[model samples]
Target: MPELIILLLFMVAAGIVAVEIKDLLASVIALGAVGFTVAIGFIVLQAPDLAIVQIVIEILAVVFFVAVILKTTHVDSTIGRPYKGADIFTFIIFGVFALAFLYVGVRFLLINSSAGFEIAQHYIKHGLTETGAVNRVAAVILDYRALDTLGEATVLFTAVIGVLAVLRLEGRKK
Candidate 1:
């Protein structure tokens, strides 16, 4: 439980730092830290498959983000300024929304988790018979949830293409 709490804290802190930091490189690093923390949390929840996927996806995302940042010109410094009234008001509104979201998410997660286990159990029992795959995970991903997997692959490919385009633009600019 303590480990979970620490992981949650790291996730939240990393998210806030990533958003608040002025430096692009530092923000990218913080985003990576957030991803690492989330992967660790998945591992802690006894989901090694999910942890592996999360880690791989996170690494790819971080690499893409860094590549894009590098392809652009960097601003040497940000001018210091006081927060505007609108900025403060927007922050407060978002803070309220965030708190409400957290409350609802926690409540939703705590309700009837056993139903989720039922689906997993059903898959484990019938996966091989239904899909004829030796490995249950493979059967699920390749057969049962093939479309979802395909969508994920598509998204990854799109991101890579975007990164390549940015790099190409940088080359052209040079």
Candidate 2:
């Protein structure tokens, strides 16, 4: 329990440092570290599926973003990008928002979500008869939530297309 708290604090600190850091490359590295920290926390919280997804997505996103930034880096860059007080205020406001979300999330973690547990139990008991599938999650996704799964599949297909577009050559077979 104490270890998880320390890890969570570390993750939050890393994320703040990442966002506030001036160098884009350093920010990406810190963000990747923070992602690993949160992924570990997710594993500890018993959602391995979500943890795996988070880790994969975080690694892919940070790598792609960093690559794009590096590719666009030029020594002859324009200067005099003025930073106003409003910019500082904007960051402060976002930090407060993050803190609020963290507080509510921790409260939810500590509380016994009986309703959710009960719902899972109910599904486990009743869904077997409704669907021939043994796995409740698969049954729910494929049978009870056909439309939702279809939407998610569509989104995944769109993401694949976007990635292909990003990596496209000049109509060359390579």
Candidate 2 segments exceeding 4 Å error: 74-112, 127-136, 159-174
- For each candidate, the alpha-carbon lDDT, in order, equals 0.85, 0.83
lDDT of 2 at 30: 89
Residue-level lDDT tens digits of model 1 in 46-155: 87888998999899889978887898844426535677999899999999999999999878867967777788788899887898886777888898899999998999
* TM-score of decoy 2: 0.67
lDDT of 2 by residue, 1-174 (tens): 997999999998998877677677777888899988889999898877668889999889898878888897623233346778998999999999999999998789668677558877877898889888887767778988889999999999999999899889778678
lDDT of 2: 0.83
Residue pairs with clashing backbones, model 1: none
Best model per lDDT: 1
Residue 37 alpha-carbon offset, candidate 1, angstroms: 2.1
Alpha carbon deviation, residue 138, candidate 2 (Å): 4.0
Q: For candidate 1, what is the TM-score?
A: 0.71
lDDT of 1: 0.85
